[model samples]
Target: MLIDLHVHSDNSPCSCMSVAEILAEARSMGLDGVCVTDHDSLAVLAQIEEGFQPDGLLLLVGMEYSTPQGDYLVYGDVRSLPSGMDAYGLFSAIKERDCAVVAAHPFRAWRPSDIACVTCENVAAIEVRNGRNSLRDDRLAEKHAAINGLPRVAGSDAHCIHELGCFPTRFTVPVTSSSDLVRALKNGQCEPGEAFPLAVGL
Candidate 1:
């Protein structure tokens, strides 16, 4: 019933959560699935996805990009972006692959001008609630999503277990292949539910 579109684990430099801890916390929080979005790396995805079938917790694989435009949550294709690629540059490179690219905390920096070069071709949604941002920032995110005519998404962007589901997003998607989840989100069939805002680096 609930799917967190943004999350991070020990694989990220800023996080320290183990895969087991993620699963347990997801269960405790009553989450149906969580996307493991690590910063600038996809190696952890291979390891995390390897054991998800047994754990019974659906895991979506994704990575974050520190673009000149700011942060982006990316899914679907991983081979296109190498580390150090600028955000706008990464969007161009991954466009052909049709990756799910969402503007992560778009208004968090108060400068959409930086990422103005980010085209809509690869962008899927705008993150409305990032666990690492304040309520004011979250509200700004909602406004950006509406202005862009993109679906609003939410996530803990959790680097820790307790951070799980703090701002979890719920997809109207049925339990199926991970691709179905992506499709559901793209078609505006999903929405963010509970939101617990945080003030990070502000």
Candidate 2:
């Protein structure tokens, strides 16, 4: 299953696209699944009903958790995790729940360096490609992941319609729910690839 592992809907303060807009774009781009990872919150869940599936495209919820080091794409029981925790605290908490955590756009422009944080035992993967990241940023993340022997994933980190699927993670197994995605991520059963060229100035 090809899934955009990180996306922002209207629930995120920086995003402009609504849930419907995101879903339409994902389907049109031929994505098998989309994870709505709103920044620091899962408010987008309100817009998703039980078993929300349209045209066989799976809709899963995650959170782009903010920390002093950088953002992390967190899957599974995000509501149980609190804010203001540092990378170690966040990872430790999520580890106990058997969830997944990926460092999001670690080398993106002005974000703090994530090398140290991503090295933690609890961090499942690192986002090597992001829609909003420059090629240089992606390169840095790629090198870091390679050097650390960490699993790599990708995400749109998309805040708008056009950004969806620019970079997405392809899983070897079916990922029909949040738990399935988390399992895939933790087991290194996925790879990141691009579906379309990113628009200029992303």
Highest TM-score against the true fold, candidate: 2
Which pairs clash (backbone N, Cα, C closer than 3 Å) in model 1? 67-87, 133-198
Q: Give lDDT tens digits, candidate 2, residues 49-87.
A: 524475778888888887887778899778788888988
**Angstrom error at residue 38, model 1:** 0.6
Estimate the TM-score of every prediction.
Answer: 0.84, 0.92
* Global Cα lDDT for candidate 1: 0.70
Cα displacement (angstroms), candidate 1, residue 135, comes to 1.0
What are the candidates' C-alpha RMSDs?
3.5, 1.8
Q: Model 1, range 1-202, lDDT digits (tens) per residue?
A: 6777778888887888886788777765777778888877877755655324554667777777776667788776664667787766776776666466777876665433243643355477777787777789878777767776778788787888778877777777684555666677668777887653432332
Lowest lDDT block of 10, candidate 2 = 193-202
Which residues of candidate 1, in runs, are more than 4 Å off?
Answer: 50-52, 110-122, 196-202
